[model samples]
Target: MPKITYITFDETQYDVEAKEGATVMETAIKNGVPGIEAECGGACSCATCHVYVDEAWAEKTGEPGAMEEDMLDFAQDADERSRLSCQIKVTDELDGLVVRIPESQA
Candidate 1:
């Protein structure tokens, strides 16, 4: 399992262990992290799981797919680093990854 760090808009941090192949949104929810509201589950149709990948971990997390990109338009503060946590798969390479949850989702 890879440990992912989720930081809320207010700077509260939750470090959770993510199973390989599970999405970041799933990991957050499993750990009771408060910011991610994965309304559509792991489906890419909703942007409720929006999060900002820390700059240092961006490349490792990779870019969003076309469908995910389209859905991100509904997210608040969508930016180069913005991604739906449900779209991010956990892997050993993502250990120690840092993601920031937006205030809008809180």
Candidate 2:
């Protein structure tokens, strides 16, 4: 399992172990992390699970797909580092991944 760190707007951090093939949003919800909403259940149809990928882990996580890019238009305070947690698949290379939850989602 990979370890993921989720930081809320107020800087609260929740570190949890993530299954190799699970999405970041799934791991967050399962662990009771208080930032990701995942309202579309990983369908990529909503921006409720918005998060900012830490710069250090950005290349490893890769870029969001076109569909996710479309949905991100609705995310508050989105930027180059913004990503929908539901679209981020977990992998061994993602161990120690860090993501920040925007005030909008926190």
In model 2, the Cα lDDT at residue 31 comes to: 98
lDDT string, candidate 1, 8-86, tens digits: 9999989888999999999999999997889888898879999999999999999999999999999989999999999
Q: In model 2, how many backbone clashes occur?
A: 0
Q: Residue 40, candidate 2: how far off, in angstroms? A: 0.8
Clashes of 1: 0
lDDT of 2 by residue, 26-91 (tens): 999999999788888989998999999999999998998999999999999999999999989999
lDDT (CA) for every model shown? 0.93, 0.94
> Each model's TM-score?
0.97, 0.98
